[model samples]
Target chain A: MEWIRFFITAALLIMGMISFISAVIGVYRFGFVMNRMHAAGIGDTLGLLCVVSAMAVASGLNMDTLKLLFLIFFMWFTSPVSTHFLSQVEYYTNRERARFMTFRKGGEPRES
Target chain B: MNIDQAYHLLFMGALIIFAVLIGIMLIRAVIGPRITDRILSINMIGTMTICSIAILSGLLHEGYLTDVALIYAMLSFVAVLILAVMYIPAKSTRGQKQSRPEMADTAKEKKLQQSQSGETTRQKARKKGKKA
Candidate 1:
């Protein structure tokens, strides 16, 4: 039983690491900050979820596991909000945004 | 090997990989051309740090580290939020006209130059493709 649990935790941990690896690669390769945000989201949501769950599994059913679950919940809620703020900053600050992004309302590209 | 040894090896390997990933993100943060890119890279670094701390808590069998990881997550979130907020006021203060009209005019000139350069590049690529 101990061996089984160990293998399970190892597997989950490996999967989480793989997710983090890909997220880092995507962030490096993507052209724009907005595109990179998509990659970062993968690590924030899936990578953290897997790793924390593995920790919870390793620790077993305890108060720590409950805390880990809450950590995951909190991250899921906050990642999008932070990403939104970052993109808003990008949208307002980048002068070349008109080249990369399409405008919805004006039908013509306008520079700020 | 036994279960304990196996667990030790696994956690050790994971920690090493996390360290490498964090280092790569540090480079990204440093070389990032734009402020948003730098902030995004910093945000990613914070996340990986949280994961590493959580893994450390498990490997060292420290319960308090779990709480530390939780607190770090909250702090990281707030840091990114605050950094973003810091950049927002300059754009919002002028009611859409932009606070620095001169900068916008220069940006427009640069955009026109970039578009012209882009068109030339596209034409060159088309000619090269057609030749083949």
Candidate 2:
């Protein structure tokens, strides 16, 4: 039983770390900030989810597990909001942003 | 072989991998071409750090570290939010237009696809035949 649990935990944790690795590689490879954000955000959400859930499983249904779940929920909420704000900053600040993306000539700010 | 021993080994491996990833992200932050790139890398690094802390809480059998992870999440979020919001009003106030070039490409693709419907294809074929 213990070995089964360890294997499960190991699989999840390693996968999560792999996601983070890919994300970092993406950050280095992508040419544009928005494209990089797209990569980083997925890694953030998925990697955190994988690792934390593995921790929770190892913890075996207790108060600590509950807290871990809360941490995930909090991260899920914050990640997107932060990304939104970051992209808004990107949109408004990148003077040549037009070179990377295409949009209407003029319109109300579309929700990112 | 034993459960505790196996878990300990796994946890140590995870911690080491995360540290390397975080280091790479740090380098990305350092050499990032734009402010957004730097911040994006920072956000990713913070996220990976939080995961490391969570794993440490499990490995060290410390309840407090769990709480610490929770707090770190909030702090990281606030940091990114502040950095992002700081740039908004100052930049957007200039009435400058920033287009989504990818969107424009997609729109152009859609137009091209629309113009290439079956009837349009047949019409082009007919025109070609007539020319021949």
Candidate 3:
């Protein structure tokens, strides 16, 4: 049973790591800054979710596990909100909107 | 290796990977073009740090790690909020136009020259009328 749990945890951790590294690469390689921000959302929320869930399982159903779940829940709730606000700030401060392909086709400017 | 030992090794590997992810984010935060990009990178690092603390809490059999994770979450929230508020006033102030005196002087000189030329043309026409 312990071996099975370990295997599960290892697999989930590897998956999370791979997603995170890819997100970093995506942030670097993506043309538009907004796109990079989108990539970051994946790594921050879902990637963490997978790894934390696995760790909670490995730790068993105890108080520690509950704490892990709580952390995951907090992340899910906060990460997107923060990302949204940050993106809004970035949009307002910079004139890089032209660089985004999505803005090229008659897109309206956001109200400040 | 025993199953328990394998679990420990797996945890160690995961911890190492998390560390590497944090390092990568730090690099991004350093080189990112804009302030918001840096904030995003820092936020990601914070999330991963919380995960690292959780894992360590398990490994060390320390209950305090959970408390630390909770605190980190709160800190991150506050930091991001502060950043958002800072952006607002700074952005609004940027939109206000404050032209330099030198630029205004040059513009004023060009307008004066145009008006003088127009007056000279009118004066010549009046002299022609007087001659007639």
Candidate 4:
């Protein structure tokens, strides 16, 4: 039983780390800021989710697990808001956005 | 190896990986070209730190570290928010009026009328095309 629990935790932790590694790679390789933001969002949501769940699995049902789960909830709610603001700031400040983004018929900027 | 030793080894390895990843993120933050890129890198580093803290708590069997991780998460959120708020233009009417105090009332009225129309770039382009 102990070995089973250890394996589960290990697997989950590895999965989370893989997600983070991919996210980091994406952030590094992507050409545009908005594309990089997409990569960062992956880490904020999926990477954290998997890592916290792995910790919860390691610790079992306890107050610590409750706290960790609450952390995930907090991140989920706030990450999107932060991403939105970051994009808004980018939109307002980036004068050369035409080079990286395409405009729709309605004047909305979309990734080219 | 025994279960306890195996668990310790797993966590230690994970911690090492996290440390390396965090360091890479730090480099990215330092080299990020635009202000927003730097902010984004900082946000990523904050998240990886939180992950490290949570893993540490599990490895150490201390509940207090979870509390630290929670608080760190909150601080990270606030940091990103404040950084973003700094870049957003303070385009409030009062701010505009205060900045343009020398403008006559009629000019201000005309400006407000144009702003109220909410003209988009597509519309402006069409107007320009017609004028041309």
Of the candidates shown, which would achieve the greatest TM-score relative to the real structure? 4
Q: Candidates' lDDT values, in order?
A: 0.85, 0.81, 0.74, 0.85
Kindly list the per-residue Cα lDDT of model 3 for residues A1-112, writing each as its tens digit.
Answer: 7777777888887788788888888888876667888898888887888878877877788888888888888888888888878876765566444334233111123322
Which residue window of length 10 is worst by lDDT in model 3 chain B?
B100-109
Candidate 4: segments with Cα more than 4 A from true spot: A108-112, B93-132
lDDT of 2 by residue, B33-80 (tens): 888888888898889889999999999998889899999999999999
Where is the poorest 10-residue window by lDDT in model 1 chain A? A103-112
Report the C-alpha lDDT of model 3 over B20-88, residue by residue, as the tens digit.
878888998899887877888888888788878877876777877888998898899789878876775
First chain TM-score, candidate 2: 0.92
Give the per-residue lDDT digits (tens) of candidate 1, residues B73-131.
99999999999988874433535655442222245634565565544454467678999
Cα DockQ of the candidate 2 complex: 0.41
Using DockQ as the measure, the top candidate is 4
TM-score of each: 0.82, 0.80, 0.76, 0.83
**Model 3: native contacts recovered, as a fraction:** 0.54
Give the per-prediction TM-score of chain B: 0.70, 0.68, 0.65, 0.71
| Candidate 2 CA-lDDT value | 0.81
Please state the CAPRI-style docking class of candidate 4: acceptable
Residue pairs whose backbone atoms clash in candidate 4: none
- Model 4 error, position A49 (Å): 0.7
Instruction: DockQ each candidate and list the results.
Output: 0.40, 0.41, 0.29, 0.49
Please estimate how well model 3 matches the true structure, expressed as its whole-model Cα lDDT.
0.74
How much of the true contact map at the interface does candidate 2 reproduce, as a fraction?
A: 0.74
Best-to-worst order by lDDT is 1, 4, 2, 3
